[model samples]
Each structure stands twice: as structure tokens, then as C-alpha cells.
Target: MPYDLPDDLAKLSLLDIAEAVAARRLPPVDQWHPGEVIDSKMRISADGTWYHEGSPIRRSAMIRAFSSLLMHDAADSRYYLVTPQCRQHIDVEDAPFLAVQMEHKDSALAFRLNTDEFVIAGPENPLRAEGDPDCPAIYLAVRHGCEARLNRSTWLELAHWALDRSDDLSVTSMGAHFSLQPK
Candidate 1:
């Protein structure tokens, strides 16, 4: 079945958006514990491009399918395409995903990832800033210990939105306050 994303996010309330995000049927990658480990020869670049054996994977559907199986193992600090039988390691330059778009729905900030996945920023999925002060990178926590770096345009939009709410370079969503300043 095709994933149905809202045509107009602004028209949806925070509860509606939350329900939509929670309704996505994702694979149980977190529960999969495969003893076999091998290199998948796949790389997710900092720019959110997926490459296999040094060639870009241009198929969006393939990317989305693989992304659903992606998981990060905090014990080894590695990412893998996990299945019931094996785990294939993959290289990630920075973040595995990129936040290509953002919207302010009700009292929360909603983000659309490069793979066309939706994530809402809140206590469970917080927004953080890192890197140098001059060129800070904003990241939002995605599931399975993964994060998505906000693209330049999305970051700018978020900054503008935050500034409109306050002057301290901070934003509040779902009663949680987030500092956009680089740590």
C-alpha cells in the first residue's frame, strides 16, 4: 500500500499529526538480533544521498525501503540493515537522513525527511545543535537511535520560526524547550 501523507499539514491539528506519525507501519528492526554481520557496501552521505558500491542509488522507493530497515547499535556505534537472519553494516558520513522540510503544526514542529518520512519534534524526538559556532548543524532525533540533519533551507526556516516566538534562539514544542545554539 502507498503511504498517505497529508496534503496540507497546516490543516492538521497536533493530535492529528501525531496520530499520522504514529500510524506508519515500520519494520521491527529494533527487535531483530542477527548474529551474522557483513558489510553492505552502502553509504549514506552527509547530503542524504544513498550510494551502493560507490554509485548513487537513484531509486527513491529502494531508498525508502532500505531506510525502514536501518538501525543504529549504540553498543558498537555502528549502523546496520538488520533482518531476522543477518545484519549488514553500512557507512554513514554524518546522519543517515536529512530533514528536507519543516512545518509548524499547532504547538509542535513537524519535519519531513528525505525519505519522505514524518517526525514530530518533542521530548521523545528532540532537536539539537552541534558543530562549530559559525557553521552549526541542527539535528532531530529519529527512531532506532538515528538522527536527521536539517537541511540549510529547513534550518533557516526553523530559525526564523523560533525567532518569531522568542529572542533567545530557542523553541518550545510539546512543552519541551529546545536550544538551537550549537553546543
Candidate 2:
């Protein structure tokens, strides 16, 4: 559960960590798939920052600002924005906007809510999350339309975008609302 533990406490809670992790991740298979974890966390820091515990890992961010949906076309859709305190070193193939992902989960569309009106700014003089150098607010939108794809496309997009290319099969999920993305 404690993904970002301070090093000093590691020795004090070794056994507690093991039990805590399993208790957090396992069970409920008959009702939920092993991969289908529910909303686990939403934390706000003292410095106007926050962290959401995501499946692949935790996402740490500063509450910059967010975007609103401006386009009517579903294909273009909305974008959720965030500013990671550190430069996220990801696979070269996963760096571009066109290939970024969206996890298939409850309230998967939550990211797109702020759409085009989000950003995170500072704690010090000239305070800004990213300083003078700019980084594009990451876009969380649909690749295509609703009809062409099934109800699970949004999270499926995230799974596919985990790699350099998209998935071969179109259908997915246990019982989540899905969407479409451009081919």
C-alpha cells in the first residue's frame, strides 16, 4: 500500500509491508477480476500536490490546472492535464501523445472531466510546477468515435497504449463502459 515509503521506515515495518501489500491487492476474484482494482487512493499534499494510486503504479502530481471539452466531435474529445514533479522517463515508444494510454476502470472517463483546463503551479518564488520550461498538458481523449468501438474501448486504449501499437482484439472488459478511438 505504501508505494513511496521513506527509507528509514523500511526496517521498522518489513513484515507489515508484506501483509499490507497482499491485503491491498488480493481477493474478491469471484466478484472482481484480479486486474480490476477499485478506486484505491486519492491523496493531496501540503504543497498543492496530489497522488492517485493507479494499477501500474502510483501517479504523483501538482494541481496545476485542467482543460474543458471544447470540441463537439467525440473523436477530438477532452484532455486531463497534470504536471509530474520530475521528468517522466518512459519508453521511447510511449512518449508521444498519439500512443499514450487510459486505464480501463471504474470512472475511466474521470480523467477527461477537466479536459482542457488543467495545470499545476508552484510553491516558491516564480512558483510553477514545471518552472519556465514548458511541458504540454497531457491529453486524455478518445482516438475515434462511439459507434465504431464497443463499451470497453477507453480502458482498452490504456492497455494497448502500454505498448508501441494497439491491441488486435476489439472487445474487452467484465462490465465497464467503453468507447472508440481512431484507426
Candidate 3:
């Protein structure tokens, strides 16, 4: 349960991000109370250290970044957290979802484009929005699965990444900040 952070992503606020996503993904879990719930497989330093097992937590971190958001959104709706296996992970039935999983050895979070507001998992994206360079970027390109860890930064990063690729980036960009509410 020990984890670390990558140099570039060592400075974000995971607690705030996780809180925001919890409110949306796991109402049952979120209702447990207000505190930190590190992913079962990962361990964060109480001393605020950003390093996992002496290595940087990048891919895993990305997963955590998105989970921070998706967990909150997973409530009420039917969505699947992509296992660190394939790209066919998400299963949205309504407007809510919460799923957390480990990053596969190959390092990938894959998802097919669907839904107006969607949570995507893939290796990475290579395309850009049609008009704006400031528009979000596509950093995901997995064929059918999402890889993730519970590192806080990863959850936030992926959410931001999704917003980047989003066609509605103009509208979503404003609400991209992490939130702390009830799931």
C-alpha cells in the first residue's frame, strides 16, 4: 500500500480532488464520513511525501485523477470502472458512475467516445480540438480499457484530460476544478 508521485505532478491537491469525486461516485462509500480513503492497493505518506515505492506514480496517478471525479459521478447512474485489462470498461446507463481500478502493466486507460459528458480511459490521445489550441487535448487512445491507481493526482489529471478532448470544452473548462461534495 505504499506509493510515490512523479516530479511533474507532485504538487497538486489530491485531497480536494478526491473529495469532489467521492461526492459523485460513491455515495455509499462517501457517506462513511469526511476523511481520506486511500485506495486499498496504494499507500500515501502521512508526511506528505510524493513517491511510490521509490518510483514515480504517473499512469497510476492519472487513474486516480479521473477516479476522483468519476467516483462522484458514478452515483445513481450505471457505469463500470475499467479494470486494468481492456478498453470496454465504462457502462453508462444514466448520468452517474464511479469506478476505480489498478493500471495494467502496459500502462493504459482506454474508452470509446460516447455520451455528452463522459469519463474516458485509454493509453493516450494524439488529436487536437478542431479550432482552439487552448482547447483540451486528447491524451487517451486505448482501444477498450482504463488503467488507474488511487494516487490523487492521477484522478485529477484524467478528468482534466477528458475535458481537454471534450467537444464541449468551452463549457466544461469552467467547471473543471475539483469539488468536495456527497456522492
Model 1 stretches with alpha carbons more than 4 Å out: 1-8
Q: Please give me the total number of clashing residue pairs in predicted model 2.
A: 25
lDDT string for model 1 (55-168, tens) is 999988899999999988999999999999999999999999999888897788998889877899999999999988778899999999999999999999999998998998
Provide the global lDDT of candidate 2 against the true structure. 0.24
Candidate 3, which segments miss by more than 4 Å at Cα? 9-79, 82-124, 130-183
Error of 2 at 49 (Å): 19
Instruction: In candidate 1, list every pair of residues with a backbone clash.
Output: none
* TM-score of model 1 vs. true structure: 0.94
**lDDT tens digits by residue: candidate 2, 47-137:** 2223445222223212212111011122333212212221111111111122111232321222211111111111110110111213211
Tell me the tens digit of each residue's lDDT in model 3 across 1-183. 543332121222344333332343321322333333333233223222223345444564444443433332234332233323211223322222122222211222322221111222321322122223443222222112221222234335554554665644321222232221112
Q: What are the models' TM-scores?
A: 0.94, 0.17, 0.19
TM-score of candidate 3 versus the correct structure, residues matched by position: 0.19
Best by TM-score: 1
Task: Kindly give the stretch of ten consecutive residues in candidate 3 with the minimal lDDT sum.
Answer: 110-119
Candidate of highest lDDT:
1
Would you list the C-alpha lDDT of every candidate in the order shown? Answer: 0.90, 0.24, 0.29
Model 2 vs. true fold: TM: 0.17
